[model samples]
Target: MALLQNLPYVPDTVRGRTVGRSFQAVFLMVLVSVLLVGAFGLRLFQLQVVEGDRNRQLADTNRIRLVPKRPARGTIFDRNGKILAGSRLSHTVSIWPIALPRDKWPMVINRLSKVLNVPPDEIQKRLEQAGYESIESITIARGISPAQATALAEYTNELPGVRLEAEAVRNYPNGDLAAHVIGYTGELTDEQLKARREQGYRLGDVVGQMGAESAFESTLHGTWGGQQVEVDSAGRIISILGDKPAIAGKDIQLTIDIELQRAAEAALGNREGAIVAIDPRSGAVLAMASWPTYDPNIFTTRITEAQWRQLQGADHPFLNRSLQAFPPASTFKIVTTSAAIESGKYDPGTVLPTYPYIQVGGIQFGDWNRAGFGPLSFPGAMAWSSDTFFYQVAMRIGGPTLIEMTRRYGFGRKTGIELGAEESAGLVPDEAWKQKNLDEDWVIGDSINMSIGQGFMQATPLQVANMFAVPANNGYRVTPHLLKDNEEHRNWKESLELSDATIDVLHQGLRRVITGGTGQSLNVPHLPPLSGKSGTAEAPPGLSHAWFGAYAPMEKPEVVVVAFAEHSGGGGGKVAAPMVLKVLEAYFKADQNAAAAAP
Candidate 1:
C-alpha cells in the first residue's frame, strides 16, 4: 500500500491506458525470454551429443603417444659360424614434440646434452631437420649406456615426453679383417630418408651404406613395431593400450673365410695392395682383403669429423682394390693368347719373327724384352711375354674379335656379386668406343697395345682372376658372390666356346709361365705345379702396379688367387706372387689341420 501511494494518482481513462500498456510490455518481455531459453537448450544438446566424440578424440590425442620398439639387428657370420659382425643390446632416447612443453624445450635440450655428450644446438638442429610430426617421437640420442639411460629414467618426471628404448646396434668382432667386403651401417641421409620414408624408415633408422651390408639391406631390415600408451599432461605413462613385438632381422652367412681373410690381410701387411681368392668351381669369393682397412665398429655410432677426415686422406683406405681396374700388363696376354687359339688363325706351334720392336699405324712399340726372343712359337711367346708375337696375334684376330672374347668372359660389366656399388666394370675399349670417348680415330697401334693389355684396355684384379678362371674351368664362368648361398644369383654361366685344343694350348702356355718363364718364381716344390701369369703395369712416377693371378695344382684348379700391389715397383712374380703364395700356404695348412683333426 505504501509503494502504491508513492506513485502519482491517475483518473479512470489514464489508469486503464497505463495498465493495458504495462500488460503488453510484460507479455513481449516474457515471449523474448522463452525464445532465448529454447535456443540455449538446443545448442547445449547439439554440443553434448552430436559433437561429443570428436571433441573427446582431440582431447585424447593430446595425451596419447606411440613409441617405437626397435628389434635386434641381423648378425653377420663367416660360413664357419665365426662372428664377423654382430649386434649389442643398447638404448636410444627419444622425445615427442607435441607432448613436450614449448617453454621448457631449451631446458630439456640443455639437460639432455650433458647426458648424451651431444651439443644442445646439434639436438635442436636434428629436430628442425626432421620436421617434427605431432604423433612421432624424434630421437634425441642413440647408443646410450645403461648408466645414461638410468640417469634419464631417474628424472623422467622432470624430463617430460622423453623415453629410453632398448635397441640392437651393429658391432664388429673382427675389427678390420674383411672391412671392405663386410662394409658398415650408418644413419640414413636426408635424401635417403625422403626416398625410404614410405617404406617405414623413420628419422633415426640406420641403413647399410656399402658392400654386402648394402646389397642385402632389404632382406636384413626387419619390420618395426611400437606401443601405444596413454599419458597425462606431464607425459607419465598411465597404461599401454596396444603393443606389437618387433621382428628381428634375418641373420646373414657369408662365403668369406675369416682365416683366409686374416692371412691375406697379414700378407698385405701395411702395404697399399689387395688380395682376392675365389673357389673356381663355385665362383664364391673366399677372401677379399684391401689393405689399410677401417673398423666397421666405428660406424655404429656417430663418425667423428677427425676420423672421417683420416679415412678420406691420401691412402684411400676405402678403395677395394680387388674390384678396381688397372692395366693388366703381361697378365693381359692371356686374353690375346686365348683369342689367338680360339680364332684358329694361329696354332700353339705357329712361329713369329723374333723382333725387338714392332711398327704399326706409323708408331713403333717396343717389346718387354729389348733383345726379344727371336722367332718364338705361340707357347714361347706367352711364356716369355713376347709383345711382338702378341702384336701380330692382335692384328690377326682384330679388335672386334678380342672385344667379343672379353665380353664372353664377363668384362666391361659388373660381376653381379653380393657386394653392391663397390665394383668397377673394367673398360673394354674398341674403335667405336675410342672414337666416341677420345674423339679420335682408332689405329692399328691401339689393337697392338691392347693385345699386350695396354692402350685403353682396363681390367680389375677380380676380372683378371676370372680371366684365368675361365680357361681353368673349361670356358664356363660363374657369377662371383660373397654370400654363402646367395639366392639372388641366377646361377648363370656364360659359355666361352673355347675348343679343347685351345684350352690345351692355353694350359701349356700358363704351365710354361711357372716352369721357365716370367712367373717361374711361383713354381714351389711342395705345391703341385702352380700355373699363372705375372703383370708389371707402368702407371708413371710411382713404380708399376705389380699383379699376379693363378690357380693351384695344374692338374685341377680348385681355387684362383689374384694379387695387386699398387705403385709397388717390381714384377708380379717378385712382388704380388709371394702374397698369393702366402695365402695358398695358409689355405693348405688350414685344410691339413682340419683333415688331421678329423676322426
Candidate 2:
C-alpha cells in the first residue's frame, strides 16, 4: 500500500485512508437503507391494520345512499261507497345535484322548466333551498302531470341526473260538496314538525289540517319506506342493496248519505245558514250542509295567495255553521220544555195566560204574533212558541233548571263530532256566567229571555238537531257522529232521568207544533205524521234568525232534521220550515217510492 501511495496518483498513506473511507461510506449507506425500510414497514402496518375499518367506511359512504319512499294516504268514502276523497298516482321530478356539474345546472333547469311548464326561477328557487352541500337528491317539482313526465323522460338523456319519482296526490271528486267535513291537507309546518318529529313526521310531510282528516291523522297517514342503494362516483345507481315496500293506509267510510247531503245543500241554496239531519236511533249524521262554502279541490293544487284569501270571505265560507254556534231562537224552547217537565214544577196540563207582550224589568218583550194565543197549556204554548208563556214557565222553574237541562241535552258544549276544532261550544248564559263574563247581575228579564232562546243563549244546528233527537229517540240523548255504524257510538248515548210522562208530553207538544201551530206549513196530508217546532229569534243589528226542527213518522221516529237561516227577514214558519221540508222530502222520497212499488 505504501508503494502504491508513492506512485504518481497517490501520496504516502493516502491510498490506505481512501480505502478505509470507502468501506465506512458503504457501511453508512447500508445502515440508512435498513432504517428506511423498517420505517416504511411500520407505516404500512398502521395504515393497513389500525385505521383500516374507518377508511373503508369513508370509502363506502361516498357511493352508498338511502332513498325514502312515501306511502299512499287513506281513501274516504260515503256510506253508499261513493268516493269522497281518494289518492291519485303522481310523479315528482328530482335531481342528484352532484351528478351534474354546477355550471351546467342553469342550462338543464331551463330545459326542464319548458318540459314542466314551470318557471325556471321556481326550479332555481327549489335548488337553492336545497343548499349547496346537500348529499341527497333534491326535489325540483312535485305532483307533475303524466304528459310533463313523458316529455321529461324523452329529454332525460340530455338532463343527466334528472329523474321521475312516484308519489300519491290527494283528490276530492265532488268540488265543494262536503268541504267542511272532509277538510284539507297541507305541508307540515315548522311548529308541527317540532311537535311530531319523533313520530317520524319529516320536514316535507303532508298532514291533514282540519275536520275528520285532522281527527284521524295517524290512521290516515301511513308509514314510510326506504331503499339502500349503491352508486358510482357520478351518483349513478350501481345496484339496490335493500328495499322495503310501504304500508298503505286504511280506507274510512262516513255515514253521510250523498243524496241527502246534496238535497240538504240544495235546500240551503246560497243562504248563510246550516242544515243537519241525523238518524235519531243510531245518531248517525245523514246529512250536514253549510252555505258560502269553498272548493276543497283548490287545496289539492298549488293555491295562490289570492285564492286562499278569497276563501276567507266576510261571511266566512270555512265556518262550519252546523258546528258553529249562533242564537238558537225558538229552537231552544225544547230545552225549556225538558226543564219544565223534568223539574215537576210544570205539567202538560199547566196553563198560563200568554199575552202579546210580557212586562219584565220594565222591558216589554213582544211575541212574534201581535195577538197571543189565549191562556194556553204547555202543549198549546209550545205549539205556538208563545214567548210570554215560556217566560212565565221559565221563571216558575228557575234559570238554573233551564241551564242544567240545556247541558243535559248537549247544548253549551261540543257535540263530539269528528269535525274537531271546527265545533263551537255555544254560549249558555246563567247567573254565574253572566256575572263573570258580562259583569252584570242575572235578573228576571234574563230568565224570560233565556226561556225564549234569546238573550246570550246560543247553540249550534247540530245541538238543535240533537235536542229534538232526544225526544225522537225516546229520552236517550244520542251522541251524533259521521262514521257509519261506528262501534264507538254503540254505547255513546246516555239514558236520561226522564219519565214516560215527560217523553209523552214532549211528543204531544211537538206534534201540536206541526198539526196546527206555527209549523203547520210542514203538516202536509200526503206525508207521514211529523212533529216539529218553528222559531223566530231576535238578533239585534240584523233580521231575526229563522229556525225549524222536526222529526218524521211520529210513532217510531227515525230521523231528525234541523234548519237555520241566519239574518233571514221572515219567520221560521215561512223561511226555515221550507228548507226542512225540502230535505225531508228528499229523505222520504226513496221510502215513498218503495211503498208505491210495493203496492
Candidate 3:
C-alpha cells in the first residue's frame, strides 16, 4: 500500500478519459465477433436446407457398386446331336485393386501365395501391373483345388480385396477333331472389346476366335443380364435386390456328320490336302476336312507362345484349303465340256483330231499320258482325260463362251455356304485378266492352256466338287451348303437345263473312268458302281498335284467326294482316287451295317 501511494500523484481527469477510450474499443471488438458468428450460422443453415439432398445423392453415387453380367455362350453340336463345344463352371480368385491396402499388399500376396498355391512374386507383379481399380486381378493357380478354394475363402478376411468367383470357361470335348470348322474362343482383346462394347462384350469377355464359332458369334453369344445388389459401406455385397437371369445362347446344329468327318480325317492319313464331300441332292457338305489341324482345346485357355508358334510354323494347318482356291487342273474339264455342249459347238458323238503334243500359236500342250488317239468320240476322250480333246473343244467354244458358262455354273465364285472366310471370285483369266496380271496379250496358246485347266484357271476343292455335282444332278447347279436349313431350299431341285445328251455322254465317260480307265482301281469289288474323274495338274517342272472328283452309286447318286493331294507326283487316279475309294467304302459299309441292324 505504501509503494502504490508513492508511485504517482493523482490525475483524475486524464484517467477518466483513458478509461472511456478503452471501453469503446472493447465494445467494437465484441460487435464484430457477434456479426461473424451470425454469418457462419446462416451459411450452415442454407447448406442444410437447400443442397442437403443433392449432396447426399452425390455421396450415395460414390458408394453404389456395380457387378459384371456374364452371359452363357451358346452350345455347338454336330448333326447327330454330338456336343462339339460347351461351357463349364470354374472358380477363379480375383482382386479388386482399389480396395487393396497399399502398405499391406505384400502381406496379402504372401498369404494368398501360401494358401492358394500361387507364387508370391506372381501375385505381387499382377497387383502392381493391374492399374485400374475396377480391373480384377487374374492370379488363378493353374487350376484351383477344392480344398485350396475353401482355404482361400476362409482366409479372405486376412487377404483383403481378394475374392473367389464362379465364371464359365469354354471347353471342347472332341479336342482337335473338326477344329477347323468348330473353332475356339478366348478372352476379347482391347480392339475387339472396343468394337463389340455395345454388343454386350466386356473387357474380360470371351468370344469366338475362328470357324463357325466366329461366323455365328452374334447369334451364338447370348444376351447378358444383371442383378441389382445391395452392399455395405465397405462395398461388399450384402444381398441381391433383383436379378435378370441371363439367357443361354441358341444351340447350333451343324450339318456335318462327325462319323463321316472322322472317317475322312483318318483316310487322309497324314497328308497335306483337303477333302470336301457334299450331299448332291441337298447341297449340304457332309465333310470338310483339312489336315495338320490343331486342338481347339488349347485355345479355350490362354494359348502359350510356344503352342502358337508351333501352329504357325506348321504347313499352314489353319488354312481352309477346301474353301481356298487351287488350280482346278483336269477337274475343270467338266466345266469346259459343259460349256462346249451348251454352246452347241460340240456333241457327245463329235470326233476331234488328236495329237501327242499340239503347238497352238506358240505353246506346246500335251495330254496326261503324252499319248494320242488318232480320232475319238467325246465319251472316249473324257474316259481317257484326253487333253487334246478338251483343247479342241474349248477352242471351238472360244474363251468368252467358256467363261460365261463356267460363271453360270458357279465357278470362280463363292458357293454361298454358311461358313465364314469364303473365297471370292477366282481367276477365270480371259483377255482382260491376262492383260492385267500377266501383262501379256491373249492368244490361241492362252486358250489352249486355259482349256487344259492350266494358265489362269483356279478353283477351290468345293468348286471342283460342285463342278462334278452339276452333271450328276442332271445339269442343275445347286449352291453347296454346310447347313441343312437355309432359305433357298426351293432352288435345289431347279434344273440348270444342261443338254440331256451331253449329260448322258459325260456320265458314261465318268463311269468308264472308274470301271476301266485311270480310276479303274477305285471301283468297288462287291458294291454298286461309282462314277468319277481323275485329274493330274502339272506343277513346277517335274511336280504335279493329284485330284479326284467323284460321286458314288452311279445309278442313284448320294454323295459326291473331291480330294486333292499337293505335290503328290502322281495322277489323280493313283493318289486321290484310292483315298476316295477307302472313304466311300467306309461310308457304304457303315450305311449297310446300319440298315441291317434296323428292326
The prediction achieving the highest lDDT against the true structure is: 2
Candidate 1 wrongly placed segments (more than 4 Å): 1-47, 128-133, 145-157, 486-492
Write the number of the candidate with greater TM-score, choosing between 1 and 2. Answer: 1
- Expressed as tens digits, the lDDT of each residue in 508-534 for candidate 3 is 888888877778887767757888988
- Number of residue pairs clashing in candidate 3, backbone atoms closer than 3 angstroms, sequence gap of 3 or more or interchain: 0
User: What TM-score, computed on C-alpha atoms, does each candidate reach?
Assistant: 0.90, 0.87, 0.87
Per-residue lDDT tens digits for candidate 1, residues 1-599, read 99998998778998789879999999999999999999998888887788888878877788888877766678888979999888887788888877755676788888888877888998887767655446668876777777888899887776776778776788888888899998889888889999999988888788888877788888777888889999888877899999999988898899889999999898888989889898776788889999778988888766778999999989888888888888888888878877887887887678888678877767778887777788887678878888888888888888888878778878888887766488899898987898899899877778888888888788888888888887678778777888887534546467678888878878888888889888877788867777888888888767789988888877888788899999998878889989988988888788879999999
What ranking emerges by lDDT with the best candidate at the front?
A: 2, 1, 3
* Candidate 1, residue 299: how far the Cα is off, in Å: 1.5
The TM-score, computed over Cα atoms with residue i paired to residue i, of candidate 3 is 0.87
Better of 1 and 3 by lDDT: 1
- Model 2: residues >4 Å from true position, as ranges? 1-51, 95-141, 146-162, 485-489, 592-599
lDDT of every model, 2 decimals: 0.83, 0.83, 0.77
What lDDT would candidate 1 get against the real structure? Answer: 0.83
Error of 1 at 289 (Å): 1.1
Off by over 4 Å in 3: 1-58, 61-63, 92-162, 233-235, 422-424, 486-490
lDDT of 2 by residue, 1-599 (tens): 99988867657598689879999999999999999999998988888888889878766766776677777899888988999889877787776655555788899888998887778997776566555445456656667767888888788777876868787788888888888888888777668978998997765677888776787788889898878789876566899998998787778889888888999999999999999999888788999999889887776655777897898769899888999888888877888888998898886678889889887768888877867889988788888888888888888888888889888887888888887478889988888888999899888888888888888998999989988988898998888888765655377688877888888888999999998888998999777899999888888899988999999889988889999999998899899999999999998996787789995
